[model samples]
Target: MMNWRSAPLAPATASQTASSEHADERIKLSDEQVAAAQIKLAPVETTQLAEHFLATGTIVPDADRIGRVAVRVLGTVTELRKRVGDPVEKDAVVAVLESRELSEVKSEFLAARLTNDLQQTLAARYKMLWESRSYPENEYLKSRLTAQDARIRLDSARQKLLALGLNEAEIEELPNLPIEELRKQSLRSPIKGRIAERRVDLGALVGREGQESELFVIVNLDTVWIDLAISPTDLSKVAENASINVTAGPDGPNGVAKIIFVSPLIDKDTRSAKVTASLDNAESKWRPGMFVTAEIPVPGRGAVLAVPKAAVQTIEGAPTLFVREGQEFVARKVQLGHEDDNQQEIVAGVNAGEVIAVSNTFTLKAELGKSEAEH
Candidate 1:
């Protein structure tokens, strides 16, 4: 990288460095004036320009976070607490029910618990009697067998209560509650989320049966999916785990998300595959159902000599760059190469370490045009 800041170039060599312009086509502005115009300068160097593929898609609810909530026991809603769009915590009760069927289940559990206690007591007593020779061996064996039968029945009853949405803690508390409170069951959300839907109304009968069985739909919108549609032509460019930037619209929500899913199969009609990314939306600003434009970076071909995109100015239909020469700025046209959103490669006419006008290149271009017209 040679410094382009050496002695002032003669007319012949200066023209050779530019795009076939006269040897002296130049624009000279003072550093103070350049600062006033907000013109900025940067050194040209070889840079890797990562290409990108643009696609449009929509934000959707994370499928993993959406929950379909229901109760296992048949019940009638007696007290409805939550409504659609209401936020809920994990295990938060959404509705209370008065279930006659549940009363029978609780009664069965209670009876089995009592029987298990009695049988265990009997088993202990029989073992004691046999060990002390107060009871015959056959008699103790009979009592032990009866106790085992009662124990098995007790375990079956506890399992049945569990299947009916009773957790171990609830089952333990069941024996402490009065019979009247035993039938009172509540439907709770298993996850922390907003209630997306409420399928049951107050006094509505709910059971473990048909489609109406599901009572609530809870969704965690903190993290969501942005589905980017990739055309088959660009399918080879998109891959899983690639970083993508998504914007809903100008002045709307925008976020950086990583591509976590790329569909293997393409839609027959649209001929496009769905590429998905996950973005954190803890603020709930990026709502579901929002259409978003995604910029997915395509892998680079290789490293090349590049310049800032802002440094290149269109002069008389030619891609011209202002090369810094001593105290003056010389307008030089350069061959262009691969370009991306931020940087464009300089295929020819410019070398690494050469200083160029990065900001306000238009003002320099106008001055160069005026200089040429004078000839």
Candidate 2:
């Protein structure tokens, strides 16, 4: 009877005892046993330590290098010679305008030239008379002054025409041409570049008072820009003239870039500093507003002691890792630096070529937690 009914087992007490025993068994391994278990742990691959900085950016045209072509006078666009994306040379004719003002300017220049010729003949005659003592010095001087005034008027008229894109020789020859042909003015491209924009179509009246319309926009696509917005915290890591890598497509056709400028002011809303990098676009494959990824290499303090990021663990906000000594893994604290998405830099508490648990760190952590609970 004593053996069969030994304090009729309580189901709750029995269950509790079983759980405690299981927990005790989990932490029952001696130090020597733990050392043996750790020997079975796999070694993590070692990597050379280096500094890395992450940033996102986009491709844009260098605005300072862009050029614009606009109509100089109010006129109807008689001809639209260039379309968007057409390559143009310096001083090439991009469009033609027919304007009444241009015709008037040509006429004024012709009349001034004729008056100047007549005055020149009179002044020459006065000079001969004065030299021969047939005219007073003052009279000859006055005549000469009148002739000089007329010549000045002619020069002013010629310059006005030239300011309107008319050559001086062209203005002098305009009166010989038909009136209908003289009225048309050709607008030329000022720079060698491709047409990036076209605002006016054929027959569009541009250059009206108070109307600042842009007839065309030209961009020199031989060089491009990489606009990177870097956080203020990382601004110190960048340097002007530093080299960077630029990837164009999704998979990336990689190219090299040089840091051109870094803005001193931070964006009010985003608090990020703007950095610009220049790239050669000689092939014209990169276009404005194209999305791109840029990688800027930040110099590190040469080689340093480090470990794989996965090997590091956080125990109550303290960064820790398992140091495999002999057959045992003891938890050790470490100071970290420059942690990228893949790997972390260990400034202290570890050395190169040392084996650490990387893949199954969570399992080790769980084992530690269970041991603590049992205690």
Candidate 3:
């Protein structure tokens, strides 16, 4: 440290002084770099990486399998134990009908049976006499014809009872029980389902077989139908066995449905075709008339790079994107694929995990336009 300041002054040439001044200028520029040349970066969120499609539809019951149980005979409802949404077993009594016509049919069937039995006994006697030559052949033949006519009458009467909704078992059991007691016929559920509608109240009169009166409508809710209306252009995308996602409420149970049928005809007014999807509704959460939104996934064109819809921009009718390169963003033209509601498919010009300007993409675009003009 001996005379260090005096030794530095001894070599104070012009070149040395200019070198010091250059160093001071460089330090000053470094201090002002942030304010003079800083780039305004736009913060953005990353896009989701997955495959999905969106569709809107409504929920409905399978009408083909659903049935309405009605009274075969016109009568007052003597008993109605079931209500809407009540699960009913097949052949379970849902209501009771007091019908005088049912009693008359049962009485006719009994009389026909008595006549058939008497004719059978007389025919047997005639057959024995003819075999022993005690009766003429024509007389025996006539007696046999009479027996056939009686049997025909019996069959006719049995058919009438069947047409009246009486099963064979009930017809056979009729003679064993009092006919008057069977006047109040219990209407059983024709199918295993939940009661969807009830039109007849207690003591209300219902129509008979010839009349048109819907007493109760039961629907098998174990399997439901999702009616999705697809636009004519998208109709070809929907195929048999296409996978669908069914949602009930905003945040309710979700179920998978399969495209069962696509209507061959397009709706004249809506210009859309009905695409039917079958879903399992054993939980009973999906009602017949409830509206639902369905997401039907059409076949994708293989996996490709994609980004958020917001990250993309349009330049001269071409889709453009801002790709981050080092500390700067570069404008690039990209080929796009099918676009959904939120995201679009990037077919080319970008790779996975590459940062893209999503928010304030227009600002990046403006910078790109300026750079292009300057060049």
Residue 213 local lDDT, model 2: 52
- lDDT winner between candidates 2 and 3: 2
Ranked by TM-score, the better of candidates 1 and 2 is: 1
TM-score of 2: 0.67
Runs of candidate 1 with Cα error greater than 4 angstroms are 1-41, 209-211, 300-302, 325-331
lDDT of 1 at 163: 84
Q: How many angstroms is residue 289 displaced in model 2 relative to the true structure, after the best TM-score fit?
A: 1.4
Candidate 2: C-alpha lDDT: 0.74
Question: Which residue pairs does candidate 1 place in steric collision?
Answer: none
Candidate 3 lDDT over 1-375, as tens digits, reads 223223211222345335343211111111122123332333333344444455678888887768877767777788988999899998888888888888887888899999999999999999999999999999999989999999999999999988877778878888888656668777778899889899878888777543435778888878888888888887777779878778877777788899999999999998889989999877777876777887777666655556778788897689987665543355667898766676787778777777666665675556445544544
- Candidate 1, 163-257: lDDT as tens digits: 88877888899889987898898777888999999998888888864235789999999999998889989999987888888898898988899
Which candidate achieves the best lDDT against the true structure? 1
Q: What order do you get sorting by lDDT, best first?
A: 1, 2, 3
Q: lDDT tens digits, residues 1-375, model 2?
A: 123133221122234334333322222223344443442343544455545576778888877768787766778888999999999998888998888887888788888989999999999999999999999999989989999999999999888888777765567678688878878987778788989899888878887542545788998879889899999888998999998878876765678889999999999998999999999889877777877777787766665555667788897578988766543355667888775556787777776667666655665566656566546
Weakest 10 consecutive residues, lDDT, candidate 2?
4-13
Clashing pairs in 3: none
